[model samples]
Target: MAELANCPKCNALFMRGPATVCKDCVKREEEEFQTVYAFVRQRQNRTATVEDIVRGTGVEEHKIREFVRSKRLHPAQFPSLSYGCEKCGADIREGRLCSNCTEEIQNGIQQQDQLNDIQERNKKKDLGNATYYSMKRDKR
Candidate 1:
């Protein structure tokens, strides 16, 4: 069930698969990854930051960040490698949002749940009261 899609990198039409970009882009990315990896694997470059890697390997910062995000580059091996949190722009090694943002989101969801519960209870109470008044009127 392969579908035709434009390559994100080159805007050329190709069959979509597990890889987001077309075959040519994927090959280019692989070469870039190899270059970056080779540079990082050097003894003196183990602690290199993403900027340093980009400068040394001539690869784009976003490409290296993408590698880190995809787990192709492990943060444990490269301590200076990190990405900004989507919510707070805090430095993080894994996931989209930082812990603080995640906790805040959880608390917001809890508050919304409580509010929904209160509204549901109020609606049920109103329905019960209406039914009681209708029954009383019928009895009279």
Candidate 2:
């Protein structure tokens, strides 16, 4: 038996499947999907951020993510496809780097570590110098 569901848009009954839409609703959805797909498929738009898609199609980010999750939209098919970072919420396509920002963050940590090491060494040197002065004064 074919599973039946009411289209959320028109409340018409239809065979259940990937979309919660009737035949008529599906047609309309397909048209809208095509418009969104075409815009995202463009080379320049391929790497568009979440904001870009929302602005371009008036579609929600969650819906776009759903399309990607269901394989309705394949990122590999679109080379410029990308997503936001899990850690920092930055726009990223591959790995975790928004690139420039990642490098900047790493450099900052390295510099801070180096400064701390220098401070620690200076503190040790000061202790040694104070001990030496006290011993010489005691002998005088």
- Could you say which candidate leads in lDDT? 1
lDDT of 1: 0.92
TM-score of 2: 0.46
Candidate 2 displacement at residue 87 in angstroms = 15
Give the alpha-carbon lDDT of every model: 0.92, 0.73
**In model 2, what lDDT does residue 56 have?**
89
Q: Write the per-residue lDDT of candidate 1 for residues 57-119, one digit (tens) a residue.
A: 999998898899899999999999998888988889999999999999999999999999999
Off by over 4 Å in 1: 131-140
lDDT of 2 by residue, 1-140 (tens): 55888878798889977766788976876676677799888888987765788898887776665465455777787554456665676655565557777888899999999999999999999988884334445554
- Candidate 1 clashing pairs, residues 3+ apart or interchain: none
